[model samples]
Every structure is written in C-alpha cells, then in structure tokens.
Target: MARPDKVAAVDEIAEKFRGSSASVVTEYRGLTMSQLTTLRRSLGEGASYRIAKNTLVKRAAENAGLDGLEELLVGPTAITFITGEPVDAAKALRDFAKANQALVIKGGFMDGRTLTVAEVNQLADLESREVLLSKLAGAMKGTMAKAAGLFAAPASQVARLAQALADKRAEEGGAAPAGADADATDATEAPASADASEAPASAES
Candidate 1:
C-alpha cells in the first residue's frame, strides 16, 4: 500500500473506532486466506474484520479515546468492530474460533468498557438483539390478552345472575296466595243443606 493510502486507511479506522459500539481483538496468526474469508462472511453486515498494523491501531485507539486498548494490539492481531450489537460479533468470533483454532480471541471492548476473555465468551452466549425484541413483543401481547379476559369476567357473572333469577321465577309458577292465611282459626265454616248430600263413596270406601 502507498504511504498516502495507508494514512487514509488509518484515518478511516480511527473514525470507525470512534463511532462503533464495540470491538474485539483477535490473533489470526496461522489462519489461511480462505479461513479469513469464511470468518468475514460469517460476520455479515453487522460486524467487520480487518488486519491493520499495530502502530496504526494504537493511533486509532488513542484518537478514539480508547487508549487502554493499546496493550491488546500485539502479534498478527486483527480486529472485529461490531457496529451493531456487541453480542452478535462475539458469538460469530466464538463460532469461528471453534472451527479455525488459529483465529484466537484475545479480548474486547463493549460500551466503552474493556472486557476480559471470559466476559467476551459470556457475551457470545447471549441472544441476538432481534430475538430479545421478539420475546418482549410476545410478552406484551400476552399481557394484553390477559387484560381483555379480565375485563369480560364481570359481564359473564351478571348474565349468570339474571339466568338464575329467571329460573327461580319459572319454578314458582305465580302461585303466591293473595292474603290467604292457612293458620287462621277465626274463619267461619260453611254447612250443607238437606238437598246437598255426599254421593256414595266409590268402591264402598
């Protein structure tokens, strides 16, 4: 690369580091060209991997206000800058490392904080940003369904009460007496005349 082109590339890297959400340092010491290509394809659009000189990287890190990252830039190091979710890039790197052992993860930076190797691995295990959002949407939908069910319960109870009252009235058949007292002892008894007589009992009962 020409001197002017190299200088421009360094400036571009610095600008990217300044704006990116996260970045991971790795040692691609023995990885073949095809292996690096596979790694790049695996990362897709959310992350980018590139090999740059350590001195340029140090300058970029310093320009990006991440001076602490200088110590990690050593020995055929390449960086994967995660412009989107940090976890996605971490997961990609972990998977790539599993297949190509030469692409080793050294450390990373997330949300402006330095991350250890263990922390980076933990980040790799997290769900993707889209997956987390989908779960949140499902939960909200379930909550709305439950609320609708709760709101309908009172109407159901009212209908049951009306049905019960209607059933009781149907069973009664309007049989309530009008001022008739069965226990009245002062009621006068009627007597029959001679012409009015009881007919012979049926079957001589």
Candidate 2:
C-alpha cells in the first residue's frame, strides 16, 4: 500500500477502535470469500468484520489507546467491531466459529477491559440488551400493578363499610317510629289510671 493509503487505513482502523462498543480479534485462516460473506451476514448490521493487516491494526489499537491486543494480532487477523450490543455480536461470532472450525476466536476488548476466549464465550451466553430490557419492563409493570392494588384497597374497604352501615341504618329506621308510638301510648294510660285511683281515695275520705 502507498504511504497515504496506509496512513488512511490506520486512521480508519483507529476510528473503529474508538467508536466501537467492543472488538473481537479472530484468525480467519482457512475461511473462503463465501464463508466470510456468510459470517458478515450472520453478524448482522450491529457489527463489522474486517480483514486488515496486523501491523496496521496494531498501530490503530495503540493510536486508540487500547492495549493488550498486540499479542492477539498474530496470523491472519480479522477484527469484528461491535457498535451495538456486545452480547449479540459475541454470540454471532461464537456460533459461526462453532460451525466453521477455521474461525478462531482469539480475544476481545470491551468496556476498557481485555477479554480472553472464555470471557468472550461467557459474554455470548448472556442475554441480549433487548431481552434483558423487556424482562425489566415486565417486572416494573408487575410491581406497578401491585402498588395500584395496594393503594385502592383501603378505599374499597371503606366503601364496603359505608354500605354496611347504610344498610343497618335503613333496617333500624323502619321499626323505630312504631316502637316510639307504643311507648307513648303506655305513658298516657299510666297517668289516667293514677287519676282514677286518687278519685276513689277522695270519695272514701
């Protein structure tokens, strides 16, 4: 490559390193052009797998202030730059490697930390961002529903108690006037009987 082209290539790789959320270095030794295309398609739009010269990639990594990738950049290096969810990208790479044994997962860097092959596999095993978010949303909705029920419970109980009191009052009101009239009639008869008894006493005197 020409000097300017080499410089541009290094700059592009460095930009990828800086812009990506995570990056996985791999050795695509025996993969054919068709297989590489299939691998790219499998990775989806969230990641870009590029075959670059190791020297340029190393220079780019160093330029981007990313360390610990120099040792991993040996022998037909292809780097997968993940701009979206790392887990999804890791999963794609892992599954593709499983199918094509020629694709070797060297190592990766994510969140300012270097990842071994085991770590990358573990990352692939994790749930995707969307799935995790959906689960969290479901949990939040359930919690909100419970809170709403709790808040409405006291009001529901109060309404029931009020209705019971109203029913009791209605039942007692129907009989209250009849009982009052009966007591009044008994009071009047007692006064009249006392007067009659006093009249007999006066006659005897």
User: Which candidate should be chosen as best, given lDDT against the real structure?
Assistant: 2
Total clashes, candidate 1?
Answer: 0
**Candidate 2: tens digits of C-alpha lDDT, residues 104-196:** 999999999889999999999999999999999999999999999999999999999999999999999998999999999999999999999
* Regions more than 4 Å wrong, model 2: 141-155, 194-205
Give the range of the ten consecutive residues with the poorest summed lDDT in model 2: 1-10
Candidate 1: stretches off by over 4 Å: 1-3, 158-205
Pairs in steric clash, model 1: none
RMSD values, in order shown: 7.8, 2.8
Alpha carbon lDDT of each predicted model = 0.84, 0.96
Task: Tell me the lDDT of model 2 at 151.
Answer: 90
- Residue 159 in candidate 2 has what lDDT? 99
